[model samples]
Target: MQNLQGKSIAILATNGFEQSELEVPRDKLRGAGATVHVISLEPGRIKGWDKDDWGNPVDVDRTLDSVSADDYDAIVLPGGQINPDLLRVEQKALDFISKFWSDNKTVAAICHAPWLLVETGIAKGRKMTSYPSVKTDVINAGAHWQDSPVVTDQGLVTSRNPGDLDAFCEKIAEEIKEGRHERRAA
Candidate 1:
């Protein structure tokens, strides 16, 4: 495990996030010694979607309006059918993600969350992967889509789904530890 001590990471998410996609990475990252913050659209607790139904609620440490991308070394976007669906439509959410790209910070997404990357115009020309259902959307966004457990390009890390959480989390930590990447204009 990479030593992420003193590193601050933000998990951007909201209600309907895949239970495992969000929790597993958040817990694993924190366990790796990174300071993790659960950032959402609003304050209070956000509910999660388990396999087929609603699961536990995670506390929100900060709201989107309250923080800037500069505050964290990396950002994570966890996917669920509903979560990314909701986030992709929010201008604030999209803008927040764009900042991460402009700053060259590690941007990680899993499952359907890659949709957020598309909406922010960050998908184009990058190698990425997401939930099978999101393949069309990613490719349509001009990304070089791949069928893999995890795919990374220029500090952006993406994974297929919950089953790939282990690789996803590990890659996220590795990217953050590598520090900022020199990325081309998006």
Candidate 2:
């Protein structure tokens, strides 16, 4: 595991996030020595969406109203069809995501989570991958979408689905270790 002792990471999600997508990466990042916090739209806990049903609940460590992108070293967006769809409409969420890019902090998304990336307007000109269903949206956002388990462009890391968690987590840690990237202009 990479040494991320002094690093801090934020897992951004809301109700309906894919259970595995959020839990797995959160565990892996914490195990790797980074301080991981779950930031949500509300206080208390948010429920997750499992394979075909509602999954477990994860406690929210902070609310968007109380925190900014400057609070962490990196941010992770976990995908579930409903989660990203809901998040993409919020200007606050989009602005928070934009701050990560503007600051060059690592921003990692997996599965349908890249939908939020498209809404943030940072997908343009970057190489990324997401659940097959999101390929067209990503391309439309000007990203070079690829069919792969995982793809990393600068500090932005993306993966296709839950099966890609291992590679996704690894790339996120690697990118965080390397620190901020000088993103190319959109």
Candidate 3:
């Protein structure tokens, strides 16, 4: 695995996040020697959404109201239909995500999580991919939507679905190692 020792990663998610999407990357990053923290909108734990039912609960390490983008080297946004749908409407979440982009920190998203990217207004003129159902939404947000398993543009990394987790996690670690990236203006 890529060595990410000394790096700190923040995963932003809420209730309803896809179980695998959140857990896999968290485990992968931690295994790579990076410190990983799950930040949510509240204290305590957030429940995940499995295929047809609710999944396990993950403890929140920090709340949105108590943390800033400057606290971590990178951020990961995990997708579940309901997770992104709910987060997209949250101004605090959007602001926190926007700060990462503005600061040029690595921001990775997978599956439906790209919806947060859309709401942050950072999708314009970037190449990204998400769950098939989100293709049109991404395109409509001015992003160049593709059908790849994983796509990376600047410091932004995105993937289509849970099946793409391996590639997605790899790209995320690669991008984090590369460090901050200034995105080209649209």
Q: Is candidate 2 or candidate 3 better by lDDT?
A: 3
Off by over 4 Å in 2: none
lDDT of each: 0.94, 0.94, 0.95
What global local distance difference test value does model 3 have? 0.95
Model 3 segments beyond 4 Å from truth?
A: none
Point out the worst 10-residue segment of candidate 2 by lDDT.
177-186
Cα lDDT, model 3, residue 48: 100
Give the range of the ten consecutive residues with the poorest summed lDDT in model 1. Answer: 177-186
TM-score per candidate, chains pooled: 0.98, 0.98, 0.98
Local accuracy of candidate 1 as per-residue lDDT tens digits, 82-151: 9999999999999989999899999999999999999988999999999999999999999999999999
Residue pairs of candidate 1 with colliding backbone atoms: none
